[model samples]
Target chain A: MSREPIRDSVADLLADSGLADDGVLAHALESLRALCPPEAPEPSGALADLLRYGSEAVGAAAPSRAAHRAAEAAAGNLSPRVAPAVPLPPRKLHRGAAISAAVIAGVGLSASGVAALGGVDYSANPPQAEVRSSAAAPAEADASVPGQASKSPDATVHQAQAFAAAASGGSVAHEQPAAPSRGASDNALAGDGAAASSHAVAPSAAVWRSERSGAARAAAAAADDALAGIGRDDAAVTASQGAPRHRADSAPSRGRHVAQEAAAVAQALVAAGAEPIKEAVALGQQVRTVAPSLAGLGSRH
Target chain B: MTDSLTDHDLVAGVLPETELFSRVYQSLAPAVLGYVGARGVEDPEALMQDVFLSVLPRIGEITGGVAGLRTFVFSVAHARVVDHYRRVERRPRSVDYDPLLDMRAVPSAEAEALVRTGQTDAHLLIGSLKPEQRDVLMLRIVGELSVDDVASVLGKTPGAVKQLQRRGLKVLREMVSEGVMAQ
Candidate 1:
């Protein structure tokens, strides 16, 4: 083939190369030349010299790239290799060392450890005379149905007496039932009056009875809630200053005993001049009635 | 007239460690940078490094001596562009390429002074085209890819590229002519 034809064919083939189309490449190059100057970065003298030195060194160097690669490969393979197993911390292997130590100490002094850990005295039991007598009396009463010996002021009291003796040699009972009477009043006002006065003294019993009076008031409230459905606006009811008429009429039917108990208790509490005891008693009764009514409402809901 | 260099000969002669490769780097690095800059690389020098690194292995495959090597380096740079985009795709798209990075040529301090002083209406005119047209035009002009390359990249045909380019140029020309006529 003629050189001209050969060159033209070669140029055609060059155009055919998938790398770039001649037209786009030509335009791009032209635009690049126009846009960017060749002398954009002035090379530093030191950098130029470094480059020259590196190039000259490579030109004259004895070790080829392949040889260098081989040497690097050999170094990688032949060098002594040590991958020591990571030393695990003692805590990692024995996860709960402190807990294990505690367990071991507990096991060594088993009974004391159980008591200490449980926050109780295992050697010294709560004086069992009361528990034994109480447990025996229940069985004895079961055997003899007519005997009311089990009801004789409770074995729990004697146990309390014994505990009191142990606590401070029976001086606690003598020093004051009055101080504990306050505690008794709180206990009496704790639940329904029977439950309240279960161990309550005269003062606590009076307070519990007043709580029964509050029950009268609450019964009146419940009757009102029943008639008015408790849905009546309190503002309107309070503004009216009277309960719904239907409840007002029926209040006496259920409230007479509660009222009598309340008045008597109130008189006793007033005589004693224990306002907190009186209030607690009153609130207890109120709570008793309210609870039932609230329960009824809940059941409906 | 020419002894086509083998890979071994090329590695020994024209690689980075050799004299010929350094000369090629000095001569072609700027042109390659300009090419990449024109296509909107923020740092064309970094792009030039990438191009050379890619082409270094396949230097002997390019047939026509230094100019041929230059073209091959550009092709490698173009491939690097595809790689850059792939990397960019992996990144959060919320991070935007800076708009200033699109300026291929930064004017010199003197030229900038003069240009600022001059009464000029120098603005991006491509904004006049519809979004699709502008996209096609930018890909063709700045990407320096053929119609087929653009089509393949866009999942279209060369015919589609030609049509869009024609329509976009026509609309731009009409807008300019209309503005001129109005004046």
Candidate 2:
């Protein structure tokens, strides 16, 4: 019932039917032969007329035939039209290399910066820190002292701190090495019990000494500035002493002059002197223990 | 088996030569005639030409090579045959008989050749079989189409085509035993 291997030609059908045994299928094929005659009937018209006419000229099923042709043509044309894709350029910079390069660059820059800096002195009279010895500090500050040490970045921070403390009337005890005094003694508060104040204030009898007040210092400076004139140009002096931000263009020379004057004033304050009026400690008699070697053990034993 | 010479060769304009198309015309025209004639068309030859005419321009669109071309050629032939029947059923000519539209107007050369062979009654005998049986027989035996190709042409399953072929053959065998077909 199933002629599975398709019989493509008459020879296949005839061979399949009578190939092995010519007995049954041969006779059957013979009997079946009467279905159509031996000779094929030819057409009256030429066969080539079919091709000669084409679909449009024939007009037989023209509309639908054209639609089918169009559809099939679309499907057929798609395969050959494809262009090969363009390849992207290969990556040159990988993630790890970039990150590592950035880290190395940062480390190199940091080392270069640290190498360019000098150490913070913090010594009592480090370079230009000796206030009283250099009487002409303000005058020589532009050419010499500023070039020496006071113009250091660390020194700027100390100056800023001193300004804040002085502006606060010594209430803001700065944590920095206080104006080179830290090297001379332990970082002690400014008020009392300083060895220099207790013993060295008067070298002989009682040379009463105190710093000149700001107004008195200003008057003395104004009087000494002209050298020959009676009344001076106060406005000119004030204008010349511009704030640091305003004087950034000529900061090095002018800034150093201001710093040296401040240092001179600070040294004057540090110079040994007796206070005619002393501030007594309000804690009447707080017991202070002295070490045995220094106290003679009078109170301890 | 599929032929290497597909419809694409025709459609692609590769087979522009008349000699090339002759290959197609030679291969299919006779088979299409038998298939169209078996369906009882008045002018199977003319209709077969029409089938090819419809196929020619669209030939490039046909895929699956010659076997696919074979299927399409037979399919168009079948539809043309159907359209012939529909036209016949729908319209009646003014005249009682139009010789051009009449199969009886002309005796075929094959029928004439078969006269000496005693197979002269071939069409008459085949005309007696069921319409479906006649289709299966003519498509398979005369057209030499495969059972699957017959199924595709007839719009039936392979099983249906096979059953029809078997039944038609059995009927023919019965006719042969009765001396109706053999004579």
Candidate 3:
């Protein structure tokens, strides 16, 4: 018998049955092993690099405090079973008390505005400055209040009452809560200013958008000039020493004029009673009409 | 320090900087490197380092002592290789090789001799097989994994792996015989 056939049969048996128990298959496998030997060659420079990498990784493995806590938590080592129990008070109570105090002060001011106003020296406080501005700028004040009042009529009345009480000396203690209302007014002023500025820029922006004719281009340039004039007037008004420095700090220079205009409206609402709320609602209607005109001008330009 | 200590015993407490780790590294590093290198990975050594580093952290989790440890290490190596390919896919295009710049001005005579006669023949022969066949054969032979272990690594049934191994070896044997007859 040719050894080739025997070798072939052995190879077939080894392939079929795997490396178990057949002496002939084993012999064939061993002989063929030389053809495709196991690659046991040590990777040159790998050992050193591996050692270095492992050492560095090991060195860096020391957990940070937060990581250690997290790991402990993951392992259930930091579970509540291991923790000490202590009763903790709710924090919301303190906030509730502050709000109650502010409400009481607001009620007092609304109940007796003349008495409250007489008790406080207006020149000493910046908010008192707002009261004076309200008298000077009733239309603007009426314009700003209705939008806010419409959102929450009851809250606006309460807020106006709070401002009146705040203007009066209900409790200097309630000033902290009143600070947030002042901040709200500042934000409202800034928002109104931004809306007006957007309106003023809309026509020029439309000209740039269409680029249809010389008339449109000239209109765009006129709008730009008008915007520039507004900006210069704002700078002059803001620069005035007697003008409320508080308003300048509350809004950006670009929105200073709009902010001042809105601030005057806010002051009028605060100083006057519920009567201004109706006027503000009317002014709000006027604003709605004017806004469409501004948007239309942008397209026409 | 004895070789007789089971992998479970070695990892019974906190993992130590003991001789056991060194022994395991010495025994498995070459096989792991070979497996990674055989796959034509860009950096087999770095991947091998990753495999070992990953193994070190999770050695305690392994059961079945030495055998389990071996399976775990190879599994980690396989996962890392898959991750490497995934990363290569997501990365920006690799630089093209310039033959003029890449070619050695003067090839090392010793290195050339090693390439001609040393391990390249076996690697080249193994490379000739289909990817699945090649993986099964290498894991079985070089990684010294059992049929089941190879199946797990390749995500195939034991029967499928056996068939692949059988087919791969047969093709290898034929190629060897043809090379011999030519000579």
Candidate 4:
């Protein structure tokens, strides 16, 4: 145990080297015991005080062993370990599936909407079609009634007498012919008998007569047939209403007026029949086209 | 009171309320309290109590028998000292040694003797060092820890701890010598 020479050698090495290398210095220093401080004597009464304080404090801070176990049980810390989690699909695959499902659902919803619009019977929904038809029917009925003068000889003769009296500047009865009237006849005849005779003859009769320009005349005739087909005589109505006998030969202005009158009458009749039919045919075509697609969708489901 | 209890026997609560636990408490608490006090902690006794209370539950996990248990207790004490300073938001200062106050108001003959012996002066000098240096010195001397154990508790490399120990002791020795010279 008397390693004095070794200690002295290490100490001289340490002093000479100025403790350059930490390992050697530490090793040399460990052998020199006096360098370390002596342990201080324990202060009196300190141990007893510490023990008493520790016993009380530890008792207060930590519950008894049984109570601690109960606490751990209550907190579920002592419960069996939980089962491992279910393995999830990879993130990219899951996301791709979600996006694909969303796209498919969107397409299906769009197709369903299109099918509902095309395939549903809109006419069966009385509130929609019936309201439209009810509103339009009265106006059409009223318009076609005056044109019916062609079907009633007496009404035609009455119109004819009125026209001749209007031409001669003699007072005569101005009646509405108990029929629906258009602007052409209404403008020409809607006046007192004396006023009708006093005023110059309406140029609407000349306008109708000027419709003799080939296809334009054919169009006028077709309009007349449509009127008659609906129980309104266009030719008789025109003649009785004093359609100009010779197209008002000198008044080129009167010819333009007649042409405008004829066009108005034709437009009113065509709108009454053709517009609804065109819509119905278009709807029928749509339903026929989409019905197969909807059936296929149903089958797939 | 045998110091030879196995780690398993201690950890299994076989020593609770036993003479062995009392013996262990008696053996370690004083040094721990002294170490805490020398750190200039506000409540050294309370901190020592806390350190022992913390050690009680985990006695079973301690390895290396009595020596390991001693290291564990001191480690708890060291942590408590650090925590005290952190909580108070100020570093521990050197205790002012008033020999007049010590001699006149001695509560007991033992306190009077302790004060007369200049141990309080030694503690004041140790406290005057930087906190890390004080920690290295205190743990080495009062906690009776090896340099490696001090490093382990303080979370420094063994080499660094040795350097701190060497420097701190050198400064403490010089301070003590100066006080003696002044006296």
Candidate 5:
């Protein structure tokens, strides 16, 4: 005769989470032991017990003394994990690197470790020679040269105001944020020098739905984007503006150039106001005051 | 017990070192084994041991005391689980012939446990759920990690962890109700 056994898993589940104190989840999973049921192998030795509960908790058996030895032997030099030393291949210069190195060696280094040969030496302090250009370069539409407004120390204040005017139109326009997305400025207002048409209005909301050609609509949208310091998408601009898609003469390029000048002017003003360079600007004022006496002395000699 | 100890307090009170690592291994061994084993990692015990070997180097420097150690340990275990599947995908899962692994010599737990009865046990019951539910349950129940720790270890949000936990518990609760009704 054989006896049948009963095992209810729902009972098992309740019993498993019976230790869970998590108010709601307490009956779900109370303790960790439910995960590793009694049917799992009992740790036989200390080494194996490393993957088992502490020997003290289970009270299964006395931890074998060999466990310590095995752990130490197994774990020897395990701390401060060092990467295996990979055999590095012999160092050889690539063709571009070889050519650059050859060129540098031919030029050699000055005592200051800058290249003795002629390309720009960025490490040197900026040239302090008085900017003598009677007219500014066309980088700036209003003043031409960016830092030219600061021709003398007295011109620093005017330089800052000029930057603000160039960037946002004036002090009042500066107060208002440049938000093209908000439709604050409906037409070309960036003062881009090459804005072709004064009449190129931002299309009204209904105009996009009207039966206008795609090129006409896109050109109007592209003009608005160009003036707002937004995208410089070559394809969109080329469809409307007569300039080649990628050329610097394009309306997008002119807008970008104007923005670049505004930023340059801002940078020059910041450099003029920086405390590190404050003393240098003051020295310029001192030299200006002393120059008349030096001229008289030179004339008599 | 660790709730009162802030991460800073735990680190301030104890030095990170080998002794702490031993304590960690002693505490987390069972959980790691159950977690990796349930996830169906190849050679679960060996991989569990490898997790410790990796932790050995960081033994002294591990912070947040036991809770921090558990999170760190489980994070490694989770990564190893992912890596195991990745390896199985990249290369055909093959191992050198070992008699110990042969089913003819030794029947597996699932093969012995409920295959004979056609009844689902806890492992099979938990396994029935989706991977996310299973991960949340395993990390919550076996690893005994808080929802936030589970989120960090699993790289999920706490809300997501909570939702997964709720769904998993609901499935298990339904199974329990059904089993009771059948009985």
Candidate 6:
């Protein structure tokens, strides 16, 4: 039932086997035999034993689920062994010290308030009225100079006559023509009735007063000349018959005369065309009025 | 009885571990051992353990049963032999000692003398050949590897391996015939 290669195959195999029961082939085989392990007659048997042991070891050492579960439980039981962190105690809030501090602060504020109010003048009127009276004193002085000038017209006229007589070589002759014209203008101004009425309210009250004064001075000079001419006739009669009546009249008239004289002198000066002196006097008066306040300011500095 | 049952079942059943593993070890171990033993290794058991230990881990890779194993074991054994030879070659040369006269392990004077003479013959014969020829011969005869395996290991063409083998054999034959070495 099996196919075979003929006897020729056997002869070929025997020839290649190189076995005269022992030949080069035997020597080659012997060389291999010599290299074989002394204890392992068959190297393949040892290899098989190793393989069996390895397989059995793998099979016997299979992982167990119970062991795996136990390991998992042990791992799960391992919580971090954490110590409890101690809490810090609450801080004490001292209200007593806080209230004391607030009271000190309130007292400080109240002291500052009392210091501010203490500077106030509560029950006393200040010296503003006294200051006002002192401030009015310069204006009173200006008024007094006008009154004094009204009573000195005759003296001023004589002084002016003297100066004119001296300058004109002792011929102190009055210009009677100029007198009538001046008298007519003065009467016109006085008759306006408005100028006389507005003596208290006129914005040009100083000019009106000055012009009235000039007319009055001219009238007084005329009266003084008449008297002087009468006195030239009889010294005794001039002194006795009219002297007492004249003297009584003179005292009353003297006040009017003095006012007229001062007016005359001012008119003579003005007629002499010296407005520069008038302006200088006005400016001098203004400077004198402002001088006291200036002194007060200097002292303050 | 259970071991017998397992053995019988293994031999007869689907997975034949007893037969497969047993055949692998039995058929191959001797060739590997003989190849290693010829190299004058004193401890053949250690070498045998190494070869099998290496092979056992990779035993599942044998695709074709005996033929696959034959190729693998021989290749591994050859690698092991080459490794052993390289290590031996690296040993220090006897400086104050005589290598020929160091025969303390030899049981008899005749054997000692023979080994000394063989050593001399080997030195002369191998020394006379070209380095390439000697390499080929050593890989073939000492390493116990086939010409093809030798070519693969040496990274040479099979033609070059054949050429080197022929030259080396020719040189050895000439040396023996010229009586350059004692028979």
What is the Å distance of residue A299 in model 3 from its true position?
81
lDDT of 6 at A295: 31
Candidate 5 global CA lDDT score: 0.47
The residue-by-residue lDDT of candidate 6 on A1-301, one tens digit each, is: 0012112222232233332342332232223222333334543343445456655543443323332332233223322356659754433346667789899999999999997776543221223422332243333223222332322333444544443333223444453222323344445335444435543454464664464444334433443542343233224333445433322223222223223323343334333323233542343244333433333332222
Off by over 4 Å in 5: A1-32, A37-301, B1-18, B94-120, B180-183
Which ranges of candidate 4 are over 4 A from the true structure? A1-59, A63-301, B1-17, B90-119, B176-183
Per-residue lDDT for B1-183 in model 6, tens only?
Answer: 011122222232344554555555554555456455544455654565566555544455443344334445555555565566666789955557776666675557887577666654455566677866755654454344556656755557888887887666556656666766544
Error of 2 at A299 (Å): 99
Looking at candidate 1, what is the lDDT of residue A34? Answer: 37
Per-residue error for B105 in candidate 5, Å, reads 19
In model 2 chain A, the worst 10-residue window by lDDT is A279-288
Number of the candidate with higher DockQ, 3 or 4 = 4
Chain A TM-score, prediction 2: 0.20
Q: Is the docking of candidate 4 incorrect, acceptable, medium or high quality?
A: incorrect
Per-residue lDDT of model 3, residues A154-233, tens digit only: 23323433454453434333322442343454454445644355445544634422321222223223323333443544
How well does each candidate reproduce the native contacts, as fnat?
0.10, 0.11, 0.02, 0.02, 0.07, 0.16
How far in Å is the alpha carbon of B17 misplaced in model 2?
4.9
lDDT of 1 by residue, B124-157 (tens): 2344566556545544443334565556444467
Ten contiguous residues minimizing lDDT sum, candidate 5 chain A: A1-10
> What Cα-based lDDT does every candidate model obtain?
0.42, 0.47, 0.50, 0.47, 0.47, 0.44
Off by more than 4 A, model 3: A1-301, B1-15, B101-119, B180-183
Candidate No. with top lDDT: 3
Instruction: List DockQ, one per candidate, in order.
Output: 0.08, 0.08, 0.06, 0.06, 0.05, 0.07
Number of the top-ranking candidate, with TM-score as the measure = 2
lDDT of 1 at B42: 60
Which portions of model 2 show Cα errors greater than 4 Å? A1-301, B1-14, B97-121
Ranked by lDDT, top first? 3, 4, 2, 5, 6, 1
